[model samples]
Target: MFVHLTSAANAPRIRRSGIRAAGRGVRGVHCFPVLPSYTLTHQWVRELARFGTRGGLVAVHFRLDDAEPVTVRHYGTPGERTTAAEAAGRLAAMEDPRGWEVFLPRSVAAPEVHRLRRPPQVAGWRYFPGAHGRRPCQCDGCRVRGEYGGRRLRERLPHPLDGPPPPTRVLLARLAAAGDPGDSAVLLDLLHWFGLRRRRRGPVAELARLAGHPDPQVRRRLVETVWRWSSPGAAELLDRLADDPHAQVREAVADAREWLAETD
Candidate 1:
């Protein structure tokens, strides 16, 4: 058995015409091969809600031949080729299966539709799986323009590589406040922000202070933060950190030199 979660509005039309593939290469339905845990089988309900489809969500149960061609992967990762039956077994063994999805290469016929019923609304993730407590990203690319409060939320936040850089004054104030308290995590985050947007000016003077901090992690973060730091003193700071007593900090200094070399 396999399941596809979609809007209730899609149900009647789907039953009459069958689930059709839309778009280019690797066209077909994105689904889950049924698992022993019922919630696990239809885990996409909550994420699907963000699309604002009419009449809420439903799970359409269907099946394809065991040997049918298919591909499976976690979101944002490349897919792997396998047969329908083998794909189910592969996903069943994943330690954390939350973000994985399966793709059937061909259309699901109307006759293959087995069951249609409501899927529990809260069964899956809202943005991405494992995102429950992390800060929500508010980048322009991530904003759903018509979503409730979407326009009101202009608060910028960091992602691994995206989102607007926070204001310099805000980051500087937080860094100054956290320095005395030795709040390593907050300091690391702020340093990382400096790493991404080097104004090539005043921030490097402030960044110089953290080079001698007790925590090697903080020093490593400083190395990462200053790669594009254009201040004349940057070379001296890198040299000082390159010989840091902690091996991990020294290792970071080694890697950061490559980035500095490229950018220079």
Candidate 2:
């Protein structure tokens, strides 16, 4: 289970568990504040120890990415510092003085203690929500920006993008054109819709025909779409993309080729 320090009251609960804070602002190190027991329980620390016992590492990630503290600023008393995983591993080894510090990202919010199921990557994670601010922020012209409709300044930005792609036939026809550079823009938009349905094999032959389109952007999109399709012809199409003029397209082709080589 993931716990969210959404308010000032909850922040101390996390701190009392032996978590400490260092550095200024959100850029410093913070601990997950979990303690271990030999036996397992529903409690988060016991859960963390159980996970760490299985060769997983634990770390406390914050919700906000910036230097500002979304909840209570101070975490706990000063102590030996290291990342959550490192601390969890040390504790799991049955070491004394069970505590360590985790470095908070300078500009990214990562707010959770999750199991690193895979080696070198914290793959499995649970996210917690922070409480909304009661009043408008005053720092760095935040209030002024809000007065002018800061985040939502654009009228139709959300509605249109969240909605559907315009039309398929129109986009496909525009993409089929021989050498018109301007048509590539329309195709790029269409790719967004098609890209989402990557699980389904759709119109592979028509897309493959444009593999040699002069515009590298269109060809890049084609390479991505072809990678998703599990068609028998996918290998041959990707082979052609291997020699694409654009460095990016060739890189995508290299990835696809490696995937095929591994899967086959």
Candidate 3:
């Protein structure tokens, strides 16, 4: 059940008896057979191309009666010849549990593998209009700035604010109008992608007004974004930043007033 071998010496010699094996990978192995179903016979697809190689990407998973467990991924061309009527027409099209139908093979010599298969799940509104909002493009700051090409979404915009301005409220108003210290390290990575530890209200009051920022690393990422958004009055602004003269902004405002008095 749930097998996914890519090639670890063409695995498959388990004749049931509580077959086990769990997980292994860099190319395959994952078993679990208390039986009740089974049938990958024909000596398991002639021992899966003797541990697949030429372009590697193999797979397998079994179960036929007690059902559920059927995967397939071999790519062919190593010593090609995977017949038995092409492994029973790819095990009857991976026993139709909605498997087998993978396309994306066209290749103009790998045009970035078709943008690595339609990635860019949006960040900084890649092609705007709330980049199709409703937390569209599966926001996590639009999938980590949609893994490059938008280069951390044009360095988390708001530089001089012209285009792209909807990602988590224009990167929390350009980290409260970043005034320097290299734009406060891109406004502390746009307040660590706006999940400023479960944010409470608009970028934790613009990181508590950048804890009187002058740039002690933007007042230590504004007392670590108010000890990770424990925001509401963050212990009365870390008791007026424990008289900061920058001993690392008074030890990050006495560690955000001892982590908001140990989480109150």
Clashes by residue pair, model 1 = none
Off by over 4 Å in 1: 151-264
Better of 1 and 2 by TM-score: 1
Best-to-worst ranking by lDDT = 1, 2, 3
Candidate 1 lDDT over residue span 136-162, tens digit each: 786544757577556455544444555
CA error at residue 5 for candidate 1, angstroms: 1.4
User: How high is each candidate's TM-score?
Assistant: 0.58, 0.39, 0.21
Scored against the true structure, residue 37 in model 1 reaches a CA lDDT of 81
Candidate 3 clash total? 0
> Which 10 residues in a row give candidate 2 its minimum summed lDDT?
122-131
Worst lDDT run of 10 residues, candidate 3, spans 110-119
lDDT of 3: 0.42
